[model samples]
Structures are given as C-alpha cells and as structure tokens.
Target: MGQEREQRPVGVRRRTLLLGAAAGAGALALGTDALATRAEAAPTFIRGADVSWLPQMEAQGYYWNNSSGVRQDLFTILKGYGVTAVSLRTWVNPSSDPANGHCGIEETARLAQRARDAGMQVLIGFHFGDTWNSVGVQNPPAAWTGMTYSRMLDAMYDYVYHSCNVIKYYGVTPAWVKIGNETNSGICRPIGGVGHPDQMTGLLNAAYDMSKQVFPNTPVLVHLAQPQNLTSIQNFLNAYGGNGGKWDITGLSSYAQGGNVPGVLANMQTIQSSYGKPVMQVEYGGPVGKATQVRNSLRAFTTGLQGFGGLGTFFWEPEGYPSFNGYNSSAWDETSRRPTAALDGFLNV
Candidate 1:
C-alpha cells in the first residue's frame, strides 16, 4: 500500500525589501564579503503542502490545465495560493511498489528542486522503509528485513545522511526533515516497533543525529498520526523520552472526517504544554466537494494551533486530481486543475 492506505482511519521580513537599497550600499561601503557572511533568517510560520505525487502525476501525462485553458506547473499554482513550503516523502526503493518509482530518492530530489525554484522551502520526510508506513504498518525495507537492531540503526543513519546530501546536491537543502512518517507505532518493524521503545528510540536518535550532521540548522521531526489520540501520542513520547530519544519538532496527521476539530485542538495544546516542542499538521484532508466545511474546519483547527506553539499545517495531496492509484478525495477539480475552495482555505490561514 501507499500513503493512500491511510484511509484505514488511523490517521517573512517584508520590510527588508525597502531596506535592500540601503543595505546594499552599506554592504558595498563595509565590504562585499560582509554581506555574503550574513545568515538568512528562518520563516516565522510554515504554510505548506505535501505534493509527493507530482512526479507520478506528470509521468502519467497529467498537466495542471486550468479551466482558463492555461497550462501551469503544480508548484506555480501552489505558490499562488500562499504556500511557502512543501513536504515530500522518500522511500528506500519506491520502484518495488506499483506506483512506479514515485517517492524514490531520485524523484524526491527532482520535486524538491522544483519546489525550491518556486521559492518554497522543502521538508524531506523519510518513510525509512520501501513503501508506505503508518499507524497500521511499518515494514522494513527488503534489505533490512533480517538485520539486527544495532545494524538497522546504523543503516538508518547512513540512509538519512546520504539522502540529505543528494537533495543538497540538487541545489536545495530541506529546512526540515521528518525522521519517519506517521510513526505512531514506531518504525522498521519487528525490532523498532512500539513494543521495543529502546530500539525505536535508537533508530530515531541515529536518524536525528545524522540528519543534523548534514544540515546542522535543520530541525528533525518525529511524526505521528491521529492527532486526536492524545493518549497514544503521550505514550509514545513518554517511551521515547524514557529511552532517551531526541527530536526537535513534532509532526501530526489528522482528517476532519476522522477526528473532530475540538479533539485535534486539545491534542495540539497538550503536545505543546507537555512536550514544549512546536507542532505541525503534516497531513490533513476532508471531503472534496464540501469546501465550506473543509475551510471552516481548517480555519478553526489552524486558529487553535496558533495559540499552542503550532508551526503550521499541510494538506495531503490537495493536487490529487484526475485520480491515480486508489487515492481520490480532497483534491482540486480535474477540469479546472485549480485548487478547490477547501485548499483555497489556506490563503486566509
């Protein structure tokens, strides 16, 4: 199964522009090297999207042909909607899946390049497996199936280090990297499952450390599904901390239809109050045609999150139109190729 399997029910400095001329003059007076040494500030908020299906969609000859009869790339369309960042998932060997190589490292780098070109930051989410991983399953890559716990941890480190370098080689370094995707039950089955917090924390720690080595400034995230399941999240965090796990951010996945907005809000509040780390809704979706409901739900959800150390929110596959694979819903219109009103909801958020 792919990300679609999640249907199983579990889960700016604008003022700087005006100062540009003066800054440039000052830099020239001080020294050109002085300006080059200044570091860029990170964005205050993260308004993002997960468009991991772009490569697959294009491979199938699908273009963003809007109702206006104009052709535009998906990244361009997303940028127009006020999206400042993109989340992409990477698999060890996606070719093994029927999706035909989507989310593979090479494809992920390609999409990340496009996102950078569109002036959006990248968030590389590693599934740490060959295929989909969620609350229901966390299958190890075929090569890692029989590895010992210690070996698996080392392999995870090497994979994350090399993958980050690969994306960097493509002229884009992810602002954030998710050590694992929706890993509520833990990752790399048999050994790193939730039952084995020691091993799970070891794997997470290895990935986090290696990722930091590559992108020292990037924040590593540990993602979980079912934001409403506050108990499950607390349990995982307790086990993780008890086992000495360390991560910089908390990532979540929730759907309005599956979890109520109030529960989601409460969970976000609890996560921040208990863990003291920023949270981001890494994946969220609702009915395709009920734009108003989707918009209102997100409006309330995002608003609640803002007061509780929330980083931002991302809608999963809002561009999943002309449906491919077994996933279809909460997507932009096929004929218009424009974001549905539900997606347009982000504009105000």
Candidate 2:
C-alpha cells in the first residue's frame, strides 16, 4: 500500500543468533561499540523511498527505465537517483487482493533481503493490521480480534518478537523499526485506542521492548502523521511519553506541499527540541506531475533537516505510475517510465 494523504502507504542479520544461548551471547557481544560504529559510519542524511508496492508491481509486469533510457531493476533505478534506503511495510495475515495483498512477515523479509542485496538500509514498518492502518483506522489483526486486553498484549509481544527473528533469519538487521503506521489516534483499537492512553502506551511499550530485545542497536520509532498539526503531535507525545511510553526516535509523516515546507520543518524542529529526540520524516511526497514544485519542496525540507536534529525523509511510492494504484503523488514519469527531476532533491543531502 503506497498512497499519500494519510491513506494507503507503504530488514535481516547475524547467523547462529536464533537460539536461546546463542541469541543471548550475540546480544552480549553486540555492545555499544559495534552499534556506535554503525551509527557513526551511516550517512548523515537518509534519502529513502517506500517501495512496498515493488513486488506486486513487478508481478503485474511493470518495468522502469533509468535516466539514460535503459530498462533496469527498480532498485537500480532508485539507487541511481540517490535513494540510500528503502522502507517496506508488513502486515499480519493480509489478504491477497493485489494492491492490498501480501506484505506478511515472509514477504517483507524477502523484500528486506532484496533491499540488502541492493546495498540499501532497511526500515521495517509494522502495520499490525490485515489491511490499511492509519490515523483513520486502527483495526486489530483478524487473529487478535475478541481477545482480552492481557491476551492482546501477549499477542503483540509475540508478533513483534517473531517478526524481528524472522527478519534476522533473512540476514538483514534493519536500521530502523517502526512500531505502527500513522498511529495519530493510537494502535489496535478499543483495547489500545487513543482514548485509553494506558492501554495505548502498553501496546507501544510492548512493541518497543520486543524490538529492542531483538535488535538492541536499531532505533525503535513511534510514528504519527501530519506533523504540521503541532497540537496533535504534541498531545500524542505528551500522552504517550507522559504515561511511561518508550521510543528511541520520533517519526513524523510530513506531506509538505509547496510553500508549507518551512512551516513543516519548523514544527519538526520544535518536536526534536521539545522531546530531545531525533526526528525523521518517515513519509512525504508531492502531487503527481508537479515535479518542479515537489523537487523544490523536498530540497527545502531535506536541507532544513540537514541543519537540525533530523535523521531522514522517505518519499512514498516514487515508483508508482498513474496506472498502478489510484495514488497520484508518485515521482515517476508515466511516459518515460523513469524518475522525474523531483528525486534530485535527495542528491548530496
């Protein structure tokens, strides 16, 4: 799922670390120094794209071309355009509805492997739903329905831990892990809904704890959409962290269009300053066909982040063409089947 406007949207690792003793030993050995080295060597700014739809697109015979007019793999085209990372979304027991299908842990792990093979870092986004999970809806996975709150907590922990272990089995350790997608109203409704901050934070902390247990080095992020709405973000964080919630980074979904880039960036700065945590634009893009405006907006947003405590920005579904989904914020040119100049915003940032 790769849609802008709070709609459809869009890792692996060490061997011998799966078992009980070995995992503990590996965790002990993977201390602060190893993690520090990775953090230090990473690029200062992350230029990423959420190509969660790549597999389905390719399965349906979609192809892409590089700037030189030569057909190539999507990953190759993205790399050629300065995409340093890829974001893949995963669901639990998802349907098989083409555009809304797949993305189970197995599929996601395979995709993460593909990203790793392409030499790009990975960010695994857990939707915790069978379909779309966003600000408007937070339905629990089918399997988790009708369970008691205690059982739900157990289920969440097991899901996250199992998912992390599966990704590790693919030999890909993600650079970042997102607990839930667009949890502006909280995740896994009723039991863990926004109105119940205690339950909400319980679910978040469970996911965070399990994520850290598996990949202690990777930063666990808590995501909320529409950062320009400062009050909403501040309230969510206040309720979350204020109620003992845990998060390593503050992830935001900023679909800044045109002149709003500066305001969005300022809000992001305020978030970082307010919480003393690094902020990442985990999702952003412009309307289709507005390559010039999109490029300028991205340039301004990323440039501003480079000067502040910002970690990265990911354009949602740059590979999506007009005929793909109903989505229209993609940066690909339908006729040329190549990226528009809009992607140049990531260059040198």
Candidate 3:
C-alpha cells in the first residue's frame, strides 16, 4: 500500500485540530500580538477525490483501475493518497456520450460500497441532466424535458429520495450532499436559472428544500461556476439567503486560469466573513498537461485562505484511469503510470 499517498491508520483517534499541517505557519511565529485576535476554531475537514472517470475507458489514465474492480481499488488508492473522502455523482439517467456508464448511479453505487467498506466518507453529486452537466450547462434530463415546473419539482424530489434511498441501502452514508452540480445558472432548465434578482432566493430555496426533507442533518453545498464572478456570486447567495435557502457550505468551481486565484480567495473571504459558512473550491483542476502545475498554482489559494475559515478542497478526478481515457484528450488520462503532480498537491506526498 505504500506509495506517494499515505494511508491514515484506522482506529487512530481523529484529530480535531484545524489545519494542523497548514503550509505557512513560519511567518506567524514572529508575531506574538497575533494571539489576541479572535481565535475562531478552524473547522476540520477531509481532502477528497471525486473519481469521475468513465468506467469503460479503463485505458484513459485514472489511477484507480486495478484487476479486481476499479471501484474497490480506487478506495484503497484514495487512502494510500491520504484522501479521506470519495464523491459519488447521481445522474437521473445515463448517456452514450463516452461509455455512458462512466459515473452513472451504477458506478457511483459500486464506488460508494467500496468506499464504505474501506472506511471513507462519501459526497453525493446529483447532476440533474441526462447528458454531462455543470453550472454552465444544466438542461433537464431528457426524461423530464416536457414536464412542467411543478412536475419538474416532483421529479426532483423523487430523484433526491431515490438517491438517498439507494445510497443508504448500499450502507454508504453521505457526509455531504450537493443538491445539484454547480447551480450558477439554475437547476434542471433555463427557467430554473436565476434571471431576476428577486427569483434567486426562491429558486435556490426550492432546490435546497429537496435535500432538507430527506437528509436533514446532512450539510447541503451550493456551488457556483467559474471564479471570476465574485460579485454576482455574493448577490446570488444573498437572494438565496432571503428565502431562508441556507446551505451548510458555499462552493465555487475555479478551473485553471478561470480567474485570478487571489480574487477567488477574496470572494471566499467575503463568504466566510459575511455569509458565515465554511468555504470550498469544490471542483478545480487545469488542462490535461497543466495538472502538475495545478498543485503549485493552487497553493496560494489555500495559503491566502489560512485562518480565514475555509474547508478543504477537492481536485476533480485525481484517480482517473488513463486506460479508461475519455472520448476527448482534455481529461486526465488515467492510463498513465500514476496521477500527475496536480494530484500530488492533495496527496502532499
């Protein structure tokens, strides 16, 4: 099991210390007066991997694929890599886009089972689309295309219920639940997008409401697309806040060079200071070749957020298998011998 990533021993006491090993504590040593400031306990969190590779593309380059089963081996590898969480995505249905079966419920369930069997947390991702989806593109799954808004809500609830029920049955409890993938535009349809400032809160409320019903204690995460639109991001949350559409966490997707990392961190500071919640850059990475640089590039973001009250971050797919290469060359090719240095930042090996 010894590799670049180190497996945290089981039965060892869990540490409550926040950012115990944060990168730059050197400069703080000289500033004795810094002690007087409010020492808000840093929230402890898990650094995790999303395992979003297409199942059939084993040749692609996800590091998780081994002989027995990619799902099982992926869990072991995550631990080996010092990651404590596994994110599973739930799509209303499947698509033939790549392998079509890549990260659908079928694969997620399998991965969840293995993760729990291996003692890891699961973060469930629900993409309300038939094909691939994200904040930038959230068209409803084809199955619900003609359905009205009311019907859509019903479908949403049913999907939520089904997801929770299925995962629970697998004996894999999710530590965090993302109601929808980056919801910057809105969920399901363009109508769901927050066009007018007034409907912003209402739309987010209705969406967040779905999670509250089934998984009351589970923290719900609201994610925005891209890092540059900080002002709009704050405004959207404020609107959501009006409807009591409170989420336990605030997340942003900052792709490589999507925006200035410092600007992104500043926006997160506002989220922490004004909104008062743990922040995370939910899905982030660079182009295929730039994965190595991502680790170094992202360091500033984490250091800037030090003591500002931010939760851990997740690099989109660190365990992807190159053998299971995506249809396009843009993704990390898991078929490669090992993950690129982008993953090394999280592994800290």
| Candidate 3 local lDDT, 1-349, one digit each (tens) | 1221123221121121114325423432222113212122534445776765534444443344333334445566556556787676777777655544456665677778877778887788877776567756877888888776656655555566555656666666677777667777666665566664344444454445445444555667787776577666766677666655656677777764524777777767877678766676677666566765676655655555554767666667654443343422232344544445565565442
Question: How do all models score by TM-score?
Answer: 0.84, 0.88, 0.75
Highest-TM-score candidate: 2
Report clashes for each candidate as comma-separated counts: 0, 7, 34
Scored by lDDT, the top model is 2
Instruction: Name the regions of candidate 2 deviating beyond 4 angstroms.
Output: 1-43
Per-residue lDDT for 289-324 in model 2, tens only? 889899888989889987875888899988887687
As a TM-score, model 2 comes out at 0.88
Q: Can you give the lDDT of residue 92 in candidate 3?
A: 73
If both were scored by TM-score, which would come out higher, candidate 1 or candidate 2? 2
lDDT of 1 by residue, 247-299 (tens): 76788888865247887788777886687567788988777777678877777
Q: Give the TM-score of candidate 3.
A: 0.75
Model 3 alpha-carbon drift over 4 Å, by segment: 1-43, 58-72, 96-102, 196-207, 257-259, 321-336, 347-349
